[model samples]
Target: MTTQISGPRGLPLSGNLLAFRKDPLSFLTRAASEYGDVAHIRMGPSRHAYLISNPEYIKEILVAKQAHFKKAKGLQVAKLVVGEGILTNEGKDHLRQRRLMQPAFHRDRIAGYGDIMVEEAVNHIEAWKDGELLDIHHEMMRLTLAIITRTMFGANVSSNADEIGHAIEVGLQYISKKATSVLDIPLEVPTKGNRDFQQASELLDKTIYAIIEDRRNEPEGAEHTDLLAMLLAARDEEDGTGMSDKQVRDEVMTIFVAGHETTANTLSWTWYLLSQHPEVEARFHQELDEVLEGREPTVDDIPSLPYVNQIVQESMRLYPAAWMINREVVENVEIGGYHFKPGEILMMSQFVMHRDPRFYDEPDRFKPERFDGGELLKRNPQFAYFPFGGGPRICIGNNFALMESALLLATIGQRFRISRGENEPAAIPEPVVTLRPKNGMKMTIHKR
Candidate 1:
C-alpha cells in the first residue's frame, strides 16, 4: 500500500496558483522542505501536481518510467514558437528528430566548433573599454546568439542580432505569459498580447526561412560546414530522404531559440555568482592564467581546464537556466510511496535540488571545488544535479553549451575582471521560458 501524499493547504479553488505566480522558487522550496520528498500540490481547482526532489524518485520518473509520461502542458506554449521540433515533440517524432540531429552534436563535430566559440568571445571583449558599465546579460545574449548563428549557419548575423534578439524576447514573453496564464486564450484572439506575439513570430519565421532558403539555393559543394548544412545533408537510412523544408525550418527555429538562450542565462548567472564570490573568482582566474598561459583556448584544452568546467558546473547547479521541468502522467504510476493517476503533472526543480544541504556541505555557498574530483557525483549518484536534465530526451546541446561556456569564460577571464556595477539592482532570476536575469546583469569591466 502506498502512503498518502501531503502538501500545502493552499487557498480554495485556486489552490497554490497565487503562491506559484507570486513566487515560484519560495513556494516550491517550502513545499519540498515542509512536505518532504513527495508533495502533492494543487495548482488549480482541477489540476493536481506533484513536486519531487529526491534523486531516487527523480530517476524513477525521468528514466525508469519515462515512457509513461509525456512533456507537461506548459511546453505546449513552446510549440507556438518552435513548431514540432524535438523540444516540444512527443514519442516517435521526437526520437526520429533526435536521431537526425545527433551527428551535428557528435563529440568530433562539436570539437571543430571550439575555435569559433573562442574567436567570438575574444572579438566581443575587444569592443569593451575599461570602466564602462554594461548589462552583462545582454552582452552574453548577444555573444551567444552570434556564436550560434555563425556555428549553425556559418553566416555572420551581427547586423541582424539586435532584430533577432528583440524578436526572441517578444516570443519568450508571449510564451511565458501563455505558460503561466490561468485561462488558455486562443492565439487567434486579437488582444494586444496576441498581436504582439504574432508580429514577433512572423519576424522570426521570416528571418529563419530566409536563411533556410538561402542555404538551399547555395551552389553544390559550397563550403557548407555548419549545423544547418549538416541537417540538410542528413538522410534517413531506411528511406534515403532528407528532412523537408518545413521540417528543416522547424528545427532551425527550435535551435535558434533554445540553443543560445539557455547558455546565455547560465553564463549570466555565472558572472553574477562569480562577482559575489571573490575567492572563487580569484581561483577561476588563477586556473585560466596557468592553463591558458595568455593564449586562446583550443578544444584540446577543455579537459585540462578542470576549474573552468567546475565553475560553470557549480553556477549551473545554483541557477540552472532550465530551472524547472515538468511532465504529464500518461498512465497511473507509483512514486515515492504515492499513487499518481493519469493526466497528473510532475514538476522537478533544479533550483530546489541543487541547494539541498543533504547533497552539498555548504549548499548555499559558492563552492566550485565541491564539483572538483567528481566529489558531488560521488556524494549523490542519483538525479540530484541535473542542470541539463537526464534521460534520452536530455538537451541535445548539453555538450555544446558546456564547451561554449567554458571557452568563453576562460577567454573572457583572461582579459578582464568584472565587478557588479554601482547602483545596479541586485540580479534576480525571473522564471520565464528560461531563468532570465530579471533586469539584465549590470557590471563594470576592469582590464587585467
Candidate 2:
C-alpha cells in the first residue's frame, strides 16, 4: 500500500507558490523538518510537487528508478537559455552527447589544464592590492570566466568578460523567475522580461558562435588542446559522424554558462565561510603553506592537500551551488512507499539533506574534519551528502569543478586572506538557478 504524504497547507489558487517564492531554502527546510521524508506540495492549482528528502528515495528517483522520470519543468524552461544541449537533452540523445563529450573531461585530459588553471589564477590576482575592498564573488566569477574561456574554448575573453558575465546573469535570472512563475508567458511576446532574456540569449550566441567559427577555420592538421577542439573532432563509434556548428554551439553555450558559474559560487562561499570560521581558515592556510610551500597548486599537489579539499567539501555541504534537483515523473512510480503519477515533480535539495541532523552532527556548523578519512560517507546513506549529485546524469564536470576549486583555493590562499568587514552585513545566499551571494560578497583582501 502507498503511503499518504502530508505537507504544509497552502492557499487554494497558488498553493505553496507564494511561500516557495518568498524563501525557498527556509521553506524546503521547514517542510522536510515537519513533514518527514516525502512531503507533498501543490505548486499550482494543477501541479503536484513532492519534496523528497530520504536518501533511499532520492537514490530511487535519481538512479535506481531514474528512467521513470525526466528533467523537470525548470530545465524545460532552461531550454530558452541553454538550448537542447546535454544539460537539457533527454534519453538517447543525451547519452550520445555525453559519450562524445566524455573524453574532453577525462581525468588525464583535464589534468593537463592544471597549468592553465594556476597560470590564470596567478594572472588574475596580480592586480589585487593589499587592503582592497571588493566583491570577491564578482572577482571569482571574472577569474573563473577567464579560466573557462581559455581552457575550454581556447580563446581569451578578458576584453568582453563583463559583457559575457552580465549576459549570463540575465539568462540565469530570467530562467529562475520563469521556472517557478504560475503564468507561462511565451518568449515571442515583447514583454520586458522576455526582451531581456532574448537579448541575453543573442549575446551568448554571438560569443559562442564566434569561437566555434574561429576553430572551424583552423588548419585541418592543427593541433589544439581545448574542449572545443575535442568536440569538433569527436566522432561517434557507431555512425562516425561529428557535431555540426549549431550542435557545437549548443554544447559550448551549456558549458560556457554552467562551467564557470558553479565553481565561482563554490569559491565565493568558501571564502565567506572561511572568513566566518577562523580556526578552519587557519588550518586551510596551514595546508596550503605546507603542501605547496608558497608555490601555486598543481593537479598532482591536490592529493597532498587533503585539508583544502575538506574545506571545500564542508563549504559545499553548507551552501551547495546546485542546491536543488528537480525531476518530473514521466510514468507511474513508487518511492518511499508513496505512489507518484505522471506530471508530478520531485524536489531534492542538497542544501537540506546535507544539513539534516540525522545524516550530520551539528549540521549547520563549518567542520571540515567530518569528512576526514571518508568514514562519514561509509556511515551514512549514499545520497546523504551529494554535492555534485549521483546517478548517470550527475554533473559531468564534477572532477573538473573539484580540481579547479582546490587549485584556486590553494593558489589564492597562499597569497591572500579574504575577511568580512565589521560594518558589512552577512552575505545572503541567493538561491537562483545556482546558489549565488546576493548583492555580492563584499570583503577586504589582506595580503599574506
Candidate 3:
C-alpha cells in the first residue's frame, strides 16, 4: 500500500481551475504556504497533480532518485514545436541524442561563439537612438536570435534580422495546449492553433532546411566557420557517421528556440530588475564602466566582471527562462515519506523556489551584492538556487545563455539606460513551457 500524501481539494469536477486561472503564481504561492512541501491541486476533470518545492525533496526526486521519473506528459506540448531533438526524446534515445549533441557545445566551440556574441550586441547597439521608447525584451530577442542564427546556420542565413524576429514572435505566441491538452486529436484534424503552429513551423523549416541544403552543396572543408559546419563535421565515433539532413534540422530548430528565447528572457528580466532597484543598477553600471572604460566587452572580460556576473546570477534567480522543472512518477515510489504513484505529475517551480524566504533574505528585493561573498547560493542542505533547474535534465543551453547574457549586458550598458514606461507593467508569470513575463516587458531606452 502507498502512503497517501494530500492537499486541500476543492469539490466538484471544476477542481482548482478557477483558482489557477485567476492567478497561477499567487494560487501556487498560497498552496505552498498553506500546505507545506507537497500539495495537490485539481485542474479540470483529469490529472490531479501535486506541486513540490522543498529543495531536498526536489533534489531526491529530480536527481538522486531520478530512476522512478520521466518527463511529465504536459511537456509534450513543447515537443510538438521543438521536434525530436535532445530536448524531447526519452530513455536510450534521449541519452544517445544528448551524447551526440554534447560535442557541438564543447568548451572551445562555446568560447568561439563569444566573439560572435559581442559583435552582434555591438551591431544592435549602433542602430539605437537616444531616448527611444524600446521594448528591451524585443530588442534582446532580436540580438540573441541574430547571434544564434548566424552561429548555427551559416552567416549568410540570417542577415535579414527583422523578418526572422517576426517569425519567432508569431510561433511562440501560438503555442499548442490542445495538441497536448488533456484531450488531443491527430494533426490531420486541424484546429486553429494547429494551423497557425503549422504555418510558423513551416516558415522556420523552410528557412533552416534551405540553409542546410546550401551548406551541403559547399565543399567539405569550406572556410565558413559556423555551428552548422561544426555539426556537419561531427561523427559518432562508434560508427563514424555524420548527421543526416533531418538530424541537422532538428538541432537547428532546437538552437533557434532554446538559444534565442532563453538569452532574450534573461537579459529582459535583468533590465526589469535593474529598473526596479536603483542601488543594484548603480553597482552594475560601476562594474560595466570600470571593466570596459566605455569600450565593448569580450569573452575574456566575463570573469573579471564579478559584480556583473553576480547581477546576472541574481537576475536568473528572480526570473529563470525555463521557470518550472517537471517530472512524472513512473512507479509507485516514496519521496521524503510521501507516496507518489505512476501517472502522477511532479513539478518544481523556479519561480516559487527563487522567492522562498527560507532560502533568500527579503526574497523579493534585488540585491546583487548579496552574492558577493557567495553565501546566498552556497546553501549546502539542498539545492535552493536552481534557475537552470537541478540534476541531469538541467538546461543544456545554460553556458550559452549565460555568456550571451553577460556579453550583451556589458555592451548594452555601455550604450543605453533602461527605464519603465508610464504603464506599471505587470511582471506576471505565464506558466507554460517556459515562464515568461506576460506583458512583453515594456520599457523606454535612454542613450548614454
Query: Which is the leading candidate under TM-score?
Result: 2
lDDT for model 1 comes to 0.89
Q: Is 1 or 3 the stronger prediction by lDDT?
A: 1
Model 3, position 185, has a per-residue lDDT of 66
Clash list (residue pairs), candidate 1: none
lDDT of 2 by residue, 1-448 (tens): 1566789999999999999999999999999999989888989898999999999999999999999999998999898888889999999999989999999999889999999999999999999999999999999999999999999999999998999999999999999999999999888999998898889898999999988988888788889999999999999887998998988998999999999999999999999999999999999988888877877688999999898888889999999999999999999998877898899999999999999999899999999999999999999999999989889999899999999999999899999999999899988999999999999999999999
Model 2 alpha-carbon miss at residue 274, Å: 0.4
Each prediction's whole-model lDDT (CA): 0.89, 0.93, 0.77
Q: What residue pairs clash in candidate 2, if any at all?
A: none
Give the candidate order by descending lDDT. 2, 1, 3
lDDT of candidate 2 at residue 277, scale 0 to 100: 91
lDDT of 3: 0.77
In candidate 1, position 105 carries an lDDT of 95
lDDT of candidate 1 over 43-81, digit per residue (tens): 889898889989998888889989989988778888999
**What lDDT is obtained when candidate 2 is compared to the true structure?**
0.93
Off by over 4 Å in 2: 1-3
Give per-residue CA lDDT, model 3, range 107-226, as digits (tens).
667888888888878877887887777767778878888888877675544466667666665566555254234455666678776676787778888888888898889875677667
TM-score of each: 0.97, 0.99, 0.93
Off by over 4 Å in 3: 156-163, 173-176, 380-382, 422-426
| Reference-based lDDT, residue 289, model 3 | 89
RMSD of 2: 1.0
The residue-level lDDT of candidate 1 at 34 comes to 93
